[model samples]
Target: MLTQTINPTYFIIDFDSTFTKVEGLDELASIALAGHPDRVRIVDQIRDLTEKGMNGEMSFAEGLRRRIELLSANRQHIDILVDFLRTKISDSFQRNKQFLTEYADQIYIISSGFREFIVPIVTEMGVREDHVYANEFLFDNEGTIVGIDEANVLSTDGGKIKLLRTLNLSGDVYVIGDGYTDYELRESGLANRFYAFTENVQRQRVVQVADHVAASLDEFLFHNKINRSQSYPKSRIKVLLLENVHPVAVQAFEEEGFKVEFVKGALDEDELCERIKDVSIIGIRSKTQITRRVLENANKLMAIGAFCIGTNQIDLEAATERGVAVFNAPYSNTRSVVELAIGEMIMLIRNIVPKSNQMHQGVWDKSANGSFEVRGKKLGMIGYGNIGTQLSIVAEALGMEVYFYDVVDKLAIGNARKVRTLEELLQISDVISMHVDGRKENANLIGKREFDMMKDGVIFMNLARGHVVDIKALVEAVKSGKVAGAGVDVFPKEPKTNDEEFVSELRGLDNVILSPHIGGSTEEAQVNIGHFVPSKLLEYMNNGSTYASVNFPEVQLPKLGNSHRLLHIHANVPGVLAKLNSIFANNNINITGQYLKTNESIGYVIVDIAKNYSEEFIKELKEIDGTIRFRMLY
Candidate 1:
């Protein structure tokens, strides 16, 4: 078991919306005005007032005044509200009740809500009456009418700040609430930080100005390294690999204390879905697909490592929405693919394939009629990305003049020239090679029209996506003597296993060379991908760094020192920084370093703080609202 080290000295929590999912005053109004003629109107008014105050559009004092004036009942209504709130405790807070009970002495509920309802709900969670600071309700002799105790500091705006300042608490003060009033404690320098608690409601006004936003109480606890009981233990974290992802990846995961399961080949969609249900991480090559069904079933999946250059097999949009980070070795296997393209180019240009087949069939026609040297031949390339650029350099070394075209602008490498359009490369070059991606736009990119545009008897090759070329068009071109020969490593439909009988339209053609999609299958490339991808997955799992994740927000975290690291993931909105800083300042937890990164959807913050701290500080951090996920790295 890992030894616990954090200690939190104070826990200032809110009542309505923070601890419970609903506003106490609105609930009270419903019971107090039960069956009254104006009950619906009065309830609506109370709810609007509550939203106004929670969103910082109206002052807490005025909102509280209006809500109290609308309440028609007395002590009985308070008991009813308490009962409802007890049933409506925040899910995360309910799950961590034991942790809260263990530190009940440090937990304080400071709210503008009435003490009559607050006491019963908090006390049920083990909080003592004296620790709860709230407004008091005064009742008539008949207990039928009531008024607030105006003398109480909490009855006015900025009252929480005023009351906390007067107490002069010796330890750090962490404030957790979902309203502008809760933010006052931090703004006025009375508390170390203000956490915008948003488990129930996300008030932008409060979240934007908060020091930190905690989506759930458990998020805060997890960030402070206090409540990780529900997190997957390292030994139990499963990594599933398919399509023969290199053994190095399995070794790397095992070395990092993760349990790894390696399958020899790709699984069908149903098999993948069943296998992924218990996995925390998954590794795959190009064959296996991580569809929506796979992601939906992979409830525990945190990261995916694509052990190849292309991530077309993985459903990235779904992965991002599920908070599953995806990584790929975009450069690890470039050399292997380029070398294969170059070799295939040589064989096709010299018309070696047909002549070799003829010799094997006992045909003794040893004519060098169609054969030509690659020297001075124009080699055209489509999609000038990593592989294309490298192929161009090597082709240039072989005395081949290179011309390429790409959808995006790419600088020429060596003497390779970039053509203005695909048509220009097709018409001018003696040989055309494809290296495009698996994007839908590239489907049949080189079809009938493209074949017609090519110079007569031109050698052709496609080592990129299988669908990037029209195999039928290429076969017709070869049969008609329009294309000299072709080399195709990938096909639109491929056999599932190595031993399966291969099939293709170009199968019987003597001028064509077909391979089982081994462009990036070299041992060196596989090993490199194995080392690169698993290390990235391990980095994210161990440190919460998403530097090269293709899907998640990217953040390059620095090495940790003698301090604890706090990781906060939240909705990408305003005021999160202020809330986090307030928590640190309120607790006097000195931050040695901090790094933050964000995308349109989420914000990630990493803070390295002084090693000496209390568990109470962590609990307070968890109480901030709008936090999606949080972690503490030691």
Candidate 2:
């Protein structure tokens, strides 16, 4: 066996409020209270409850129960809430989504959340659903709130610490987040680095635990391994970064001797195909689509990165077939999003949008008639995954009660009760928000019938998918007074250019809030995306690693101590292995240990031969037929 040398580095991430823009549970509350006047109070309570639990003042189970009982919510509100929550993902996380896809097998989410949300979101990020290890929630035969998977690491105290030790990672470990639970990774010596992300709200306990503190993700990356690494040996690595990826991520790649290229917005399939021909690394956010055609044209691509939380943009099967590795910064921008959702929920609950518009328009219409408090309100959730569960805690702090619903049952979080159906959540909530996944079936999820289910004069918001709601129908609903007000962060057809003219069906409407889909566009979030994405991309290119990869078959090759490593990518056929063995035999090469792994179409073989093998030996192997490609990696 080749002696194992120290590998460069590794990362451990928290799922809920790290990479995504909003706390998943907070979005659930937003959905739950869609049209209710009590929305703001519920959010505050959840937040406070979470803080109390993290500080070791209360049991997680008890804290959760207290918050849920306060909410007094049900199923109807959850359906609409699911879509809103789903849309609150961060741009940074979306941009680096490829890192997880390309390296699907290596990246993991050790969240204290439900699989109902994490599974869908992680799968979209190109991570195998099975790779996600988190708490599971179950429902009864009649679809009522039930028990949780007590054995899950997330449900257990210091569970992430235990899980990391079991991994026995060959490389160094790093952790990033804004919560006390995330800080535990460092306290337990499971992580070599702990980055405190402050783009969202920063906790004193979490800050104290972090080894490195960053205001923006960009600043953090600048101080880390990105630009300060070794010099390039070849023509600089060509990099393409989409808008969602922070410039810092590109800078990090450049630090590793790469030539970084930037694009400020989304790209169509054809455009991506055209731009990726000479690129070694491709990084994008949620809006940039990397289809099968894009993968086929990536002749020089060593890795693809989605700098955001999701990798649904890229065609994973296509990238795998072509052996293109993908990566993403799963936890890099989560706090930013969660923070935003919390802030938005407060803003909406206090009737801040209408007042803000009045102030901006120089009206100064300080009317107390419509303004209200979030305290004592019921908050509902649709997908009680990472952001959802975290939001549940934050909401409790804001003095709000919380309830959640998932198509596939999930664990109760922070006293948040689980509801039976989406319809029940809608009927009970005063404010309804969405936090569902971007599945094909999720298209047009909120239509005329669904909107008609909510309480009249309720606040409605969607931070989730542009495709989930029928935009025109939403406009109609708002106009007809079915919804009291709306805060929409995403639109069905947004302009590609930032300076382009924007027109919307809801324009000229009063008491309606419209955002530029910047829920997680904080400076802190950009910096994290910048810092995390390039590191993942560089790791894949410099070493054939699948950590944080979303595409290609997951493979983590052992570090070869003696250097002469042969990489073979061949068609998966019966004779290929025999032919490779014969080539080694005829050349008098004494192979150390060879690893063979095959997928449906290709077989990847790594052989460690003597460092001083003759040039003729390589030539002989090159002459073998059926070898798709053969070369020395290092």
Candidate 3:
């Protein structure tokens, strides 16, 4: 109905790799020639020809002839191809089904692909059968071998231009496709505009000559001021990826049509607050802090992606209280951290640092007095979490006896023994490796009192939160020989960037491995984190799924189907659900499904309805008591 408000015009669309997610001929070859020895080579040739034709490198007719000669397809194979293509429709096209159905009369699908395939797919999408112009497949009597009808204009190089000229009553015609043929309509003065559709595939030559390149059909419709299923265009959703998030994450966001602003380094509180106000999503690593003040300025913020193992750098409470979902890579870098801990434990226990340092100073002290193998030594783990439990298993594999202590009851792995208290593990073990979280209460968890309880000359390490251990206490204990060589990866106060000077009291200490918080800084770890955290943020943003959110209630949702979904985040007070249902009932809106999840402070409700609602209904939902945030997703 909204299409009625816009200027009337003809919409020319492509079929394969434009209307669908894959090339029809390419997929047809695979299905038709299944179990055939030449299937792969023939399919590759078909795809190559498709690319050549789309890029305008070869004649369209020649490409089509070569592809048809290669595909051993029949009438039955065509039917199977049709079924497969029904599932491969472009994501943007799938979402805008209503727009297609409502404006069926103005739309035309002109593709070089066969009419047998295009008609079944587009007509199902509500386009009139007569509006579909494509090559016809001419089959033999046995229905085994086939060729395209050469007389059809679509079988030629300038087919689209020739066809548009014949149907010349069009007013302000628009061509949308991934091929150069589509742009030919515009170049020949038949079309007013040519949108290079890149939702499924992109050809550079086609892209360069296009009047406008659209990432999706949604984008094209949005550009034309046509109503669509999405509440707002993805291009308008500003994503701010700070602290040099991996390029994989940047590419993922950009592919989804987000306007990404990537900053290579961390921003301070005031700087972040100013930049975050208009950002819908913000991605950060460990250095940048998302404080309550920073969150207060994030008016449009929907999700926060912490591209590291720790969420301590973010204000989870403030993020959740503001109805923002926070996602982090909790187990992505688990192996990296555990490996670092194991490496450090071996180096410190064997006195490798002091020996190596002595050699560097030309002392040549090779005495094996304090040097000892890690074999049979008691290894004490302070936290039995992902990293902690992994370290326990690995240390046990290295022939070290593992002893772990955690406030929460964690099942011991391998021959690892669990202690009820940290003091019990510290008093008995030979090496203490801290692998805890960064909670406020965990600050100074290992102070003078805990250090004094450890055995004399005990090897120690802290690869967990820097604030958990009192650095000054560790320095004094190391000097007094109460604690032997220590490996300290994280620190209480670290410089923002690598260029700044690193000043620490333990800087001059001997036999100490002081790393700059790179326990999980491996390339493998960064890549894993990059892929993981962005996916979680994207899922939360696109589907309202908070499966692994640190603070919000976890809800894993299926892919949204033929329905409009509404996400309502409100204070965890009674009667909110009843009130929401009452509004829907009063409006005669039918609820398809409703999901509710709650945390201590807030409740998250996801409601699915069969049809679109009025703007007044949105206002009613927002005006509901205790409502924190409301968003519509399609």
Best by TM-score: 3
Candidate 2 displacement at residue 342 in angstroms:
1.4
Q: Candidate 2 — worst ten consecutive residues by lDDT sum?
A: 226-235
Give the distance in Å from residue 547's predicted Cα in candidate 2 to where it truly belongs: 1.2
Better of 1 and 2 by lDDT: 1
lDDT of 2: 0.69
What's the lDDT for residue 125 in model 3? 85
lDDT of 2 by residue, 1-634 (tens): 1112457455455666665655655555566566778778887787677667655466765665565554433344444444554575543455446555654555567666556666666677677776676766555565443566666656666767777778787776767677777777887777878887655556787787679875434334445523211213222458888875666775576545455788888878888888888887888877888888787888887678887766767777777666677787667766776676777777776778777777888987756776678788787766776667777888888888888878877888778888898889988887777777666788888888888998887777777667888988888888898877788877777776687777888787777778887766788977887788777666556655555666444567776555567777666778877888988888778888787877676777778887666778888777765566564654
Sliding window of 10 residues with minimal summed lDDT for model 1: 1-10
Q: What is the lDDT of residue 102 in candidate 3?
A: 82
The Cα error of candidate 1 at residue 406, in Å, is 1.3
Question: lDDT for every model?
Answer: 0.83, 0.69, 0.89
TM-score of each: 0.62, 0.58, 0.75
Q: Let me know the TM-score candidate 1 reaches against the reference structure.
A: 0.62
> What is the model-wide C-alpha lDDT for candidate 1?
0.83
